[model samples]
Target chain A: MSYPRLLRRTLLYIGATAFALWVLIPIFLIAISSFTPPNEIYAWPKPIIPSRFSLDTMRFFLNSYGVLNSLRNSILVALLTLAFTLAVGAPAGYAVARFSFRGREAFRLGILITRMFPTALLAVPLAVTFIKWGLYDTLIGVALIHTAMALPFAVIITTGIFMGVPKDLEEAAMTLGCSRFGAFVRVALPLALPGLAAAAMFTFVISWNEVFAATILTVNNRTLPAHILTTIQASPLYFRFAGGFFMTIPALFFMFFIRRYLFHMWGGATAER
Target chain B: MAAEIRLEKVRKTFGKVVAVKDMDLLVEPGEFLVLLGPSGCGKTTTLRCIAGLERVDHGRVYIGGRDVTELPPSKRGIAMVFQSYAVFPHMTVAQNIGFGLRMRRAPKNEIKKAVQEVARLLQIDELLDRYPSQLSGGQRQRVAVARALVMRPEVLLMDEPLSNLDALLRLQMRAELKKLHREVGTTTVYVTHDQIEALSLGDRIAVMREGEIMQLDAPNEVYDMPANVFVGGFIGTPPMNFLRAEVRKEDGGVYLAVGDFSVEVHKEWQEKLEGMVGKKVVLGIRAENIEVRPTPEGGALPARVVVSEPLGAQQLLTVQVGKDVLKVATSTELSATPGQTIGLVLTKAKIRLFDEESGEALKFD
Candidate 1:
């Protein structure tokens, strides 16, 4: 209605729009640059566009230094981590939510405490232990460590999901025909499937994206994140940008797969606790 | 329309707190047995014990003459409709009702037929394709009943199943539950804290208090001749009014001394209460049985109506008598405003007396 109000409103809109662009621009540039010809990629302040697009840099990242093997290792490691976390975490979540066993409250507190310890603190000791166990470069070793890393989060997410399911329904199942375990499998678990799916996806992504632990834990058998670190940096800024793009694709794809349950299980919960 | 069920000294304890304490009950074949009590008073625990959902700490359970305390619910041949319906959200109504049938590995054709028949019986045939979330509260309630009945188990246990429904729906469902039980002929154990439900639906009601059954009999008998103060007070609408009183023998005549007045014990009651003479007791009378009229020839306690709750057919009158407030329900269609002086009479036949210390009925031994 007034000029100052109009100007203020216009300034606010521009500020908000600029903020959004600032966040998304680097991601967009990495995607475009990852496909650019390496000869022109490092030119000047930066090429506004890749006049000729090629997959050479992406192809190079895939083959050289066994980056493709790293990708496979990361997927395999993440999958194993997801499976183990869900297997161990789901039951733990159910027990913490539904039962009143001794030290149950302490068990929940213990899960939280495990997450509080810095990953760096465990890296050296874990590496030393892995070597002794003949698992230093093995995917299973990486997966087990990743499970411990992802377990607290998996347990917390699924605990919330199990709590949301009314206890009356499970008890009702018990009365009808189900044993206590049967009720969980036939009733509670199925209802919590979406939340469990999201938890598994998240644990996978966390395992996939982890580099410090991966670097410390392995030498030749490395994950994508650990392998990328050796070649992603170049004398040129463009290679760094290209590597960023390569690391982000799997995460973006995985995020999309569980995007529905992200807002559902994680967004509301993970932010607070 | 119900199966026979028996509990022999069933006792359940949760840590230090006893939930159902050494309860023994019997339900006749084709009869509806309702366990009624306040929250935490063990009605639900009793029902769950019968369903084998909860294990008894020290007793045996029997359904249709076979010992079932050691058997699981399915093996005991019982089905339960939960307060929350317990219908699987992922399945259609048909699948939910047919689940037990499938568990029995019934022939596919028979399972389909049973589900269809129960669906039609409960008028949920059209809802068979829909999920539980798609149905209304009342529709889901019917679906739960259909689910339990389709199994045709020997017994059916329901725990406060109608409590989640709206008032109008509750009344409608109560009537429908009676009709359904009549048709299905499964022995049913229904539990509720609502006195009205206990009265209306239970063929025989067991009034429980503090983990023990106070009284168990035909619903009308439990209502009319309650065993003790708690049963008398707990099994009626607005609850029966209880006041401290003393029974005394005066001038070769037996009398009960109540608040602000004394009434001559009717000859029949005089003999039954002879032992309570000169003893302090609780005077119990239902709200409706406490008549407020113009001093009826006998000396009646004069009181002022403190508040009047007027329903169209009947009204509840809260009156002050000797520093104690009493609720009196009237069917005379009389209107009395607050502070209006009224004569209240406690008719002898309708009066109940209990020992003050033990709270046990003081009747002829």
Candidate 2:
């Protein structure tokens, strides 16, 4: 085509490539640090090339302060958040997509409004409630708070997903032999499954990385991120690096696992307006 | 093998906007019934109401003579193929076809046999394991049909199913679909805005307008005798022309006078125009019925050829008669140029008279 048009395309491609590298460098650095010698973690130029590596730092972080249990706690909370989000949020999402009620618009606005509040504001009050309810230091209690935190977003995202599944397809299912609920479960649900998986991934990451509520609500049930925050204060510098490495590795891997979905959700955001 | 479907006095509305109003129709068993209309003419809404996709505000819906107005769609044993094809993107052709059976918790072997049977019937066995995204548009349409057929639904409702296909594919699918219906003998309600498709495919065509059916009749009869000006004008491509005219008595013969030109009313329509010989009326003549002449005769009118559109095998010519433009389809491939002057005669046999005030076609009785 025209020279200016070709030049613009090249520049856009290069700019996107540069942005991806810029975002990944920090993550890459933390991962490499896990292999650096403990003493050289203190050295200048920051051990870009480690002469020797050891599993010592990683092993140490894993065994140090119930870090394993913290990881276990993190998985449990993420899964529980997923379960609660899907169970409660799916029906609510279906309702918003299929029916009109008196306060439907207001309810949608209210869901969005919940996302605007800072999660930190709930820490103290939630802590008091959890202690009073005898759930102060349990993984179950921790998961409940995280679920509450992720619930609104789950509802909003799944609602959009269900809306994308053609309303006619569900009705078609009904005439072929599905009850109203059965059609949702049979036709609509399967069609929206990919979107639901993305919603679950989002809620999982939110629960996994949540530190404020996890820190306020528990001592014994400290999640992975909360445990990392505590470990960084007193641990050796390399141990801190190792802990950060473990957390980012899964986060990076999981993000990559659902990169296609993330692109769609992100693209969907930009495309709508 | 197909179910009879009937909608008696069915009405549906969303707030103040009525989507369907007092719709009453019958689709005979094993018959292909086409709902023909423009977008938002309540054809799709009527299909959804029959499918229970939309609840009726008033009246009843029946399938195979059973009241299913309030029954959930699934229990009514009707299958619908959507305008978009609606093949499950994540599932393979086999899985998509197997879905309804799977929902019923049919035994594994039975589901397999049903899927295979439908796959063969639709000639999509080669695509059984391929996902919808992998299939071409025509193949996906076939898979959707296979999916609905696998359910063995008593009635098949297709909502503009072929509207998304390419022109050639649409024609191909139309033929194959007709053949499949012949073999399967399923009563089908097919909706389309393309009157060509409706006329060609529907055993009986229902021409609808503004949430109400203007006429429901056999394709040939409807085309030959439209109930009103809207049906007369909307049913044909290149449409029928309306010449503003007045009924006048001259030499004891009734005739319509349009501007400086007049066409003698045939003896057959003389009595039809008896009321107020000076009253206004509209004369509707289909394009193909406008005969071109080399020289102006007593009944011939002068016209200027303005535009010529070459439709394969025939050329569509637009002629301006006085202030009115009329389309004429001619099989003679003689290249005609715009700005050419010619004389055209409106054949007496093809003239349809309508009351200009009410738009209703006039009958002698």
Candidate 3:
């Protein structure tokens, strides 16, 4: 390689590494703080590397009032929200992708319009409706709202995935002795599996980290994010740090679970024969 | 099991577009019937209608002796090979070929045996464990054919299966497909836009235009005696040439008159075309049928050569006769040049006359 080209390539690597560190450093500091002793975390001009590691701060956060129950509530709500979003959104996505019916554009526009409204805008009316339906302070009510919030994105993502799969595969399957539904199950569903997994992971993350609707819809069944927000000001910095770190653990696990599909979904690598 | 297929008064429309209009067709048991036409001529639509991928608006479909118009594809007992070769990308070759048997809930051992048998028959047994992504285009197409054939359907439909390959591979697959069809004999209905493919593979060709069949006959009959002007113009390399003329009665016999030149009608056609006297008709003749001579002969039209293209075994001579330019295939050894005068005679070959306005053959069959 020529001198200038080699120098330019080396410079590019340095820039990329610096940018990666810039984004990762804050998350690393929070993670370390979650395991530091309370006194160590409070030291003036705190050491860059922790003097020692301790799980006492994490235990304190877990034992706090309603924290463990809220942790259970968060997990349950995220799973339920993921289920609801897929059940309602996947069929809608398929319909939009495969058909050219009247009002299709209008229906897509309607879904887009729902996303334009901030969650706070619907909180008051939804709260009243939940109380009237006797669903107040329940995990199901919050899950319903979270599902509504995540559904638009899920529908759009799944629509793109289903469109990428060729319709010829389904028609071939049907002609090879499969019914229309059977063709979908045997061909289309398997081809779109990676995209569906990515959509489900995204929904789980949205519901897991959501605070506004969860706080408004329930009191005793507050999700972890809502619980952390409610107790942040009253608690010490170490408790706040541990609570935030605990809230992030599920998102990390969800990413790890769907890592195989993540590159394909985001990079648009068709990998078709 | 081979079975005759029938479509009666099949009409299909998409919104306001009439794709197949009032069509009726029949395929004799184990006969290879090809639907040939240009794109958007409803040939593929007709094949899909037979496959039950598209429901007819007002027609009944029959396979064997059973009316399968309302039956779903699964119960209708037919298999199809798609033009795109839609093999399941996630499955291995063995699994793809065995999918139909698995769907029917056959015993696991039976499915495996059937898959192995089909792979060996297609000479793809060594590739059974490989996914579709690992195969070449021709290999993928073979896998698709194996998948369709393993079902042992009563009928098999192919929609331009060889149109996707390169020219060399297409020729190879075309011969293999013909051999397979002869051995299996499953009453095939193939569709293609290439006339060569239709002529080489079809026992009978159905040429379609504007949602209707223009001619349904054997390959040579359609080539030599096209039913109408469209079929004449649509088939053959460099297509058949056409000239505007009128039938005239000069002394008791009939002759076709064109600008200052005429050819007496043959005795066999004189009676059939007697009613066409004084009527404007379009005469159709193939390029190879016209004979070019160096000197004027009896009843030969004099013309100027516009271009001479030598193509090894024969030469294509474009000659201008009066106001029309006609392509004549002649011997490559016959020396000719642009602006040179030549004598063109078409009396010895078959002639087709069509009603110029309606574009239909003039004589009743």
Give a tens-digit lDDT track for model 1, residues B196-278: 99899988999988999899899888887888878888887788788788888878778888764786667887766676678
Q: Give the clash total for candidate 3.
A: 0
Per prediction, the TM-score for chain B is: 0.94, 0.95, 0.96
Per residue, candidate 3 scores C-alpha lDDT tens digits across B1-365 of: 89999999999999998999899999999999999999999999999999998999998999997999998888888999999999999899999999888888999999999989888888999999999999999999999999999999899999999999999999999999999999998999999999999999999999999899999999999898888889988999878888888988888888898778887667878877788778998888899888889866776788899999999999999988888888999999899999999998885447788888988877744
lDDT of 3: 0.89
Docking band of candidate 3: medium
Off by more than 4 A, model 2: A1-29, A40-46, A94-109, A267-273, B101-118, B150-152, B310-312, B331-337
What are the per-residue Cα lDDT tens digits for candidate 3 across A1-273? 999999999999999999989977877888999999988998989898888889999999999999999999998999999999999998988887888899987887688798899888888999999999998999999999999999987877777788878999999888877889999999999999988988899899999999999999888889999999888989999999898788788788888776665554344322321
Clashing pairs in 1: B2-B30, B2-B186, B2-B187, B3-B186, B3-B187
What would the per-residue lDDT of candidate 1 be over residues A181-241, giving only the tens digit for each residue?
Answer: 7877888988999888888888988998899888888889889888878655542555566
Clashes within 3 Å, all models in order: 5, 5, 0
lDDT value for model 1: 0.83
Please, what is the TM-score per model? 0.92, 0.90, 0.92
Model 2 agreement with the true structure over A1-273: per-residue lDDT tens digits: 899999999999999999999988877777777887677778887657777877777887788867898999999988988898889987887787778888987887787688787867877888888899999988889888888888887777777777788876776666556777887777788888888888888889888888888988888778999988876888788888898888776566667766666554444333421
